[model samples]
Target: IPFSSTTKYQISIHAMEEGYCLLAMKGAPERILARCSTICTESGTQEMNDEMMEICDRACTELAEKGERVLGFADLVLDNQYTKEYPFCAEPPNFPRKNLRFVGFMSLIDPPRPQVPDAVERCRSAGIRVVMVTGDHPVTAKAIAREVGIISYEEVIEAFNINTIETLPPNLPFAKNKAIVIHGAALRDMNDQELDRILYNFREIVFARTSPTQKLHIVEGCQRLGEIVAVTGDGVNDAPALKKADIGIAMGISGSEVSQQSADMILLDDNFASIITGVEEGRRIFDNLKKSIAYTLASNVPEILPFLAFVLLNIPLPLGVMAILCIDLLTDMLPAISLAYERAESDIMLRPPRNPRKDKLVTRKLYFLAYGHIGLIEAMGGFFVYFAIMAEHGFMPMQLFGLRERWDSESVNDLLDHYGQEWTYQNRKELEYTCYTAFMISVVVTQWLDLVVCKTRSNSIFKQGMGNMVLNISLVVETVVACMLSYLPNMSYLKFYPILFRWWCYSLPFALLIFAFDEFRKWRIRKYPQGWYRKETYY
Candidate 1:
């Protein structure tokens, strides 16, 4: 018979000259010690009494307190008359187990990895609670949990004075700061409501001598309290709890096939520290996704306003279709992709996990900032450069208004300008393309500052620095591509024309304005974290 939590022991029969001898029966120290009626002494096998049993129990506890796992061994010999009637080989369970001679106890120690203490400390500082669950004796489990910093030694002393949880006062509130250790025997008597109180109260819990069913009950109780549970296991007995947890982690090297199949993720190294690294990486990816989305959406206002003006105000088109395509597909693609490589901010792990119901990737505040604030400013800057280029060519802003019909007509060869200058149809068409190129340049320039601002949500750009090599290279490439499209010769098929150097300089002030405004917004959010500005404008 194999050892199980229910039986707590394993039995085997061996042939002897007189009869079959049940030799080397090993199991849990307490269970095996219970059936012993005699002890093996140097003189002979002596009858075991209550005083001798207490002494043996104290020895076993002392070994367990030193972080050693203890197992007891015993043996019993069956006489030929009894063995012939029972058939010991076929009926192992029916074999005589009581009145066995107690041999001794065997203790083994498996120390935790050195990196576990530091990882547990990190989890504590990040507002994550750490729990220890094991099938070892309570003293051995508490010793290991204390060594790994799950609970302090003083807490163990204070909380475990009572033998069982039923001895505690019923009306006494469970303390959140105190740590508690519960035995599986006590858990078997607890109902769902009692289990919930334990899960909700203790920040650090050690469950010792637990069966597989008790582990599953703990996971279910936590889930009912709206907590996110992550369970780690390496045995077939752990498969049920691992499958029920929100994030199930299995050991790659030591984990059984049943546990691995039930787990959501497998740790190749079987180290607890790797889970911390996985958490930091997951948080970094989420932050970068938000940055990329914000950067892409902010340019929409500037791109759409030109066509709106062409329709509502009846002015010449300030930007062309081909130029808009270049902005979306060429100049903007790499910089947005580069945001994914941005380093995590300093406080990524310091904050508590986000609420999936209330906190979202895309919020109303994000849409307002992208469209109503930063996008509106970029649209104004593009329009300023467009009107500046047109006015320098003897076409003022007011004269350009309502000129869409004559501007596109092939029959109108001579178009009168604000200064009474007669312009040929071909000359006016070239000026329109120049305005298109200038507006596109303005959008590109303002986006340079937008990309920097989007790198962090709460930190200043100076603190974050421009340390990302990929984003810096992307910015340089974006500038080079925009300038090449503007100044390259024979590029009229793309509606790109060379513009004056001063037209590119016109958008610099607006780009600086964006940086200043975003810095001020970040400052306000940090100065008063609980203020209305953080709630309404922080995103």
Candidate 2:
């Protein structure tokens, strides 16, 4: 190529400015003056003899065969102004471009991340298949993949590669080995059906020399096989594939803006281990959401049953409407919110992902748990407080039933109690307000245990610990709020009265009962996951 025709230019040593012309430096001595340039491999190679070339070729082959990256070395003799303005013009005088010297070659290896092997093993243990796709040469790709545990260090008999000539293989491998390495050239001509077939069969794979479109096709093919694909990339060319994936992960430090914008997740540390941490964290969040929802819903049964009984049995309402509002908006609210901060159960990542079609936030088992089991028990606790207070003061449990009309009356002043005390309408009305306060306190107390139970769905409370300081702080706040709402002076608008502290203490055992019962249920569920009892009772 002519000097002007050459779009790019490079330095040369042991050669003149006029293309290897035999011109010596000024004031020549035995030692060459290398003031303006440096001695490097490109120069070293040209001066090297045929024997040296054969040695370098062998060294490079050995290094490359071991999957090490090689960099060629050559000698570059320094020169003055001539190097800066070296003439590439048609051989000035009698010079020709030839002969230089070479130094040696270097083999470098970029070691894999320290945590990568462990993370890859964890993914394997979780039954998650990981595939590596890169623009590197096949040897380098295979080496890195093996280091990261994506592929075992074995060459399978039915391996696929760039060597395949047909657009589709004459007969696809049956995938007994499960590990296959494919080049971008092999995938470039593959139709979607062929892509799907290969991906659907192989559990472990590597794609080398892939273009951006080939990567996008791989992601789409995975989705076609109902796989939840997570594509990770850092380049602008990777944006399309990242967007096409089910979940896209972008490296925050190394990623291009287009890829980061297209991705659903960002790895701030640009480490493969961070993705595993993210997966664990994501599973915890989902489990915590379910717990928060279940705890929030458990309080509803106790809240609604009071009104149901009042309307049916004609008793003065055990819990007032405003009190229900207080339980939902005040005492119960923070505990439910605190559940979001709870840590995961022990086996959060050990189990497979719950099927989207089968597992739900509100399942049949959850409904039975909230409204039938725990809720039924809590509702009984509330009524127990109500009846116990009414009976002790004057009225009997049976007499209070069917008494809503006379108890709430403006005219009636004489209601006979089982203790033979004749109570006026005003006195009876005050007692009814006290009952509402007791019911509210009952819910508050039981819900504290509910919070603890909800900390873990299946794991024992002892096993998970009351995780997250927020839960403890919220429970404390719940207790104080319940006390203030029940006994604050002149707070008639809230329909709460200063009830006896004895009624508050009376409800403690029921809360303990709830905690013990839930712990037992958890044990049963864990011990017998496939048993009919667990299937029927687990939420």
Candidate 3:
């Protein structure tokens, strides 16, 4: 059966009725057997022979022994067959108060996971607070909450006496003004009074005597104060509240089918530890998305640098529209996709949650790093290309030259002829070498710089030993491929100037120089305080 607890009860009952021989049952084993056998009936079976009677006797003895050892609860089914025989009693037995040592009873009567406490504490460290809400009595709730490290053992588990909210303990110190133990009756009747007080004035609060409706109300009230609520539920009654939360977390293992359907995410193990896993996943997703935005903006700026320079210097655009499309689609796509899979930085969860209102383009310090460093690298590369040509001409080169350095009178016309040929037709294949080389140098070096910038804030900037071996290897491979690509032959039609195959080899040092400059910038930003690099305007 999907509900193992219910299945165990049914199985145990059948075992008891069949007179199955008992071996050893204690603790969880005993509880499980008892719960399973609760529905079993030995009433109309054959008359108890010696062996049968002995089996029954053993079962009875075991039940009594274990009953005193654990908190046992059973559903009392009344025999409606008999009438009340006109007997009336004036007073009922008064259950003792001190005997109520149960701090909290979980509504989830399912067996507890042994690791809930450790998992909860880890979440607390990640800046996500946990507060337990259950229909169980205050004593039982408190016990579990303490065991799970959600609350301390010294605090009293506050409970309202029945439906009356006013019956709560008077002159309560408010336990840091958070009412760590706010009963469900109070939560439902107070119209967000305790909730608003807690959200505004308290650090944390634990709720008890909560029904599904009350749970939903609490979630809504918390959201009103701008708190993002992740509600976890696994039962039929929990479906409505789970649907209402900002992030609905459902238990996949023990959760009801309805609850799982309503939830945004289902925890595979039904362990509280899985909740922590989900939060980590959310953080990683957000981080990778931020990286994508940073990478796209940085990448686009560099690709467009030659064009921007052409506009500024009143020169013809070195790259045509098709060339821009080719580079954007081919050269830039792979590395940007690679950035999406960048491994989580060591401090991903160590920091607090990013504000939802924070803009990926504007608010974060990473954006500044992306624009400042990336723009500088692009401009430097373009300047070198322009300077290399100018130096070759002695002043300015108006005449176009082939790979063999022979002059062509119609320089622009010859360049257009080269652009319209087979080399251009298969630009992805031919320029695969050059474009990829440039892109490789640009991205890998920039990302490494990005790593430095990210780590410096955590005082990790000084830790040069922390390097990603895989990223390092990928960068080496990219550099070697780019270097070898420059020497590919048969390039006369591709350019008016001599194909500086050796320039590909030369670009490597510049790439490394870019990396060093980025690191220097990070250091300068920290060491120089008010002055480092010039702030460039960006969207």
List TM-score per model, in order.
0.90, 0.77, 0.63
What is the C-alpha lDDT profile of model 3 across 1-539, one tens digit per residue? Answer: 12222122111111223333212111222233233233323343243245643564455444433221222222222233222332222234121111111111112244347777778877777877787876544545655676667775464535353333344343335434333567665675675665565555544557765777778887888788887889888887678778998888898888999999989989888888878876787776666666556655665555566566456654433444443454455444554455445556556566566557653434446556566666556546544554443334332323222221212122322322223432222332233233333443444344444433332332233453445454445445544543333344543233212235444343445456655665666455445545634222111
Number of the top candidate by lDDT? 1
lDDT of each: 0.86, 0.75, 0.50
> How many clashing residue pairs are found in candidate 2?
22
Tell me the spans in candidate 3 whose CA falls farther than 4 Å from its real position.
Answer: 1-112, 152-179, 316-326, 359-367, 396-477, 480-485, 492-539
TM-score quality measure for candidate 2:
0.77
Give candidate 2's error at residue 165 in angstroms. 12
Per-residue accuracy of model 1 over 146-205 as CA lDDT, tens digit each: 888998636552233224565654442545356778877877788898878777767788
Give the lowest summed-lDDT range of ten residues in model 2.
Answer: 27-36
- Using TM-score as the measure, the top candidate is 1
Write one digit per residue (lDDT tens) for candidate 2, span 120-142. 98787766789888765455577
Question: Lowest-lDDT window of 10 residues in candidate 3?
Answer: 97-106
Better of 1 and 3 by lDDT: 1
Candidate 2: where are CA atoms >4 Å away? 1-16, 19-65, 69-108, 152-158, 161-177, 356-365, 532-539
Task: Give the range of the ten consecutive residues with the poorest summed lDDT in model 1.
Answer: 155-164
